[model samples]
Target: MPETRSYTLDIESLDLDGQGIAHHDGKVVFVDGALTGERVVARVTRRKPSYDKAQAETILRASAQRTTPPCPHFGVCGGCAMQHLDVAAQMAVKQRALEDALAHLGKVRPDQILPAMQGPAWGYRHRARLSVRLVPKKGGVLVGFRERRSSYVADIRECRVLPPHVSALLLPLRGLVGGLSRPDRIPQIEVAVGDQATALCLRHLEPLTDADLRRLRDFGEQHRVVWWLQPKGPETAHPLDPAQVDALAYALPAYGLRMHYRPADFTQVNPFINQALIARALTLLAVRPEDRVADLFCGLGNFSLPLATQARRVVGIEGSETLVARAREDAARQGLADRTEFTKLNLFEVDAEWLRGLGYFDRMLIDPPREGAFAVAQALAALAPAERPRRVVYVSCNPATLARDAGYLHHVGGWVLKAAGAVNMFPHTAHVESIAVFEPSATAA
Candidate 1:
């Protein structure tokens, strides 16, 4: 139990969640809406044996990095966490957090820290899942992200992270949904924006009436957006009229590539940063024309296709059959199928033997989910020096997991941490994306 009374505390640092950390009576306290080096009066919201959670009520002293949030629904909406902090400060904090994780958790340090990759601070999100709820007391319906620290949907007319056109559709979408046969039945709307068109996938619990279908068509026509209906799982989602929809795709002009993907398929949320990341990853890989490369956990061949353009042969391994099939199609469309191979395999279940059975790779690219490719790291560490890839470039969405795997690679596998840096994939949020390069140590080789 926590005391209802407020207490004055000094914020020492910012945690990974962007909450300020302080010490009170020998217990750690996490204070929301506080910045590092700020003294604030906070009231405890929840308590645990080792720590307490609080919300800052009054700022006795404000930090230089603190700024007024641009979004009106900043605190209530869970979409953006560090909007109150200056954009430059946000990137600096993320970089520091990455270095700290590498040093403290991994007990390894990069020989060189690459410059933090950055891009636009607003209207950069290309993919998002908006929540929907019907509340008669407050309003007819609410459509936006979930509230901070809550499951309830936040009432927002516009989103700062979404594109200007999509943000403008928020109110229209609310009306569009409220007029539906069962507004409450539609629990979520997934947004996917491509270079040419935008898509809105409506997840309904029950079958929609002809009137509801007509409303969707009218909205789509007026807004110039596609409507996808999902009565059940994500796979069930299909465009109401595929003929009217433009093929959802993004272009990598540098590689002369245009990658197509379904609305439900996994793609980077930030297209600007995705392009920069791919260029950086390829540079770090130093792919030679004769090199045989392997892309682990490749989704939709984002990296494999690009690598295929440079490498003699590129092998992509993924866990999902659907993603593998799509990757193959994309490779064929890009005219890289002859040089690229797509395989469906659970990388998480692989070991040294399984990895060795696949033969040798000159270099490898790893773009895994937040779980951080621990099993793959273990397999690489278990492999003989001759069997291991000569070089590896890892792209991660989680700093902590990247550090853990970096530790295993450096400490146990005799790999050198050549370079690592943070990527600002999601601006104004606590999320930290990073890239690292590793090579076998001279002694081990």
Candidate 2:
């Protein structure tokens, strides 16, 4: 076996991917499992001309922020990083990640930094997809997260981060899989929670035997969680019991809203942060009774509903017809049908004329996926400096794209970045969810 080369370096900061930064002989090295202000010995994993990748071999000094992770699968499971750090430390790392992206990539920063959004650390996940693997040598199946740095599934019977009910189903699901003829071949389990009930979708490689179906049905009746069997892709997912006893939904009590979604629909796992995000986004919009607001890429009217509370009318545009229909239903359910309108459109390719055809809207609230709204943002950037929206609230999942779009809005759109902040949507991971507010230039009107 080749000996692993070791180097001692002082950790400077953390990168967006949860890697630790260290300057070794003036070359910037990023070491995994290292923290800021900690001196450690690292074994180089991959070497590059300008930098290198390493794993912390020895933490000669550890930060006070470091904590003993609760899960036994901490290091071995590839599901989460930052588990070894305190929640406060996790928030700090995320904040720095946002700041680094803004400074290094965007070359611009918000005039004010809003407080970081934080939430419950454990059992907060409303949705999850657990991997399923049958390891006959150990037991019947290894079901849970992937193993660290490997595709192999981590044998996790209990997960502290998932909602207690969902976590409790892991072992039973594993046992149930064992009863299946092709237990190992049966792939993953997806858990999605709605307001009234929880739904579990199990992906199977082959049709279930009659006896296997009975066991699954019995488990479903006992657990109160609807079981969905997926023989093919997500579209093939159907209830193990077609009685329609359970429905998947999530609620925004503040807005008197409850949304139903299929198991595969996009919903925030951390419900608390999402509620706060909706509240903050609407607040930033500062919607008035007479204001007309446009919710670009709106799904299920999460932001649109809240905006309707303040604005005179809210026009929500989404890429999927299903989501638009769902949003319309939600609007009717909330008695905001007259105030909120839903439209299905490709947000990526929209323009001023297209938007004008829909309606005249002065305020814009956008929440784009990880790809970000390159085209939508570019159009916003091209809006005449004198005719731009008075306020725009942008929510994003990817910081790089947010920064890229921010650069265009700040340098091109003649908008002032009022405030920006980070939200801890995915705890213990490097993913940063954030919102930014941009106001038109003072003299634009």
Best by lDDT: 1
Pairs in clash, predicted candidate 1? none
lDDT, model 2 = 0.83
C-alpha lDDT of residue 443 in model 2: 52
Indicate the worst ten consecutive residues by lDDT in candidate 2: 352-361
Model 1, span 138-212: residue lDDT tens: 778899999998998999988999999999988898899999989989899999999998999899999999999
lDDT of each: 0.92, 0.83
Highest TM-score against the true fold, candidate: 1
Candidate 1 accuracy as TM-score: 0.97
In model 2, how large is the Cα lDDT of residue 197? 86
Name the runs in model 1 displaced over 4 angstroms.
244-246
Q: List RMSD in Å for every model shown.
A: 1.4, 2.1
What is the clash count for each candidate, in the order shown? 0, 2
Which 10-residue span in candidate 1 carries the lowest summed lDDT? 242-251
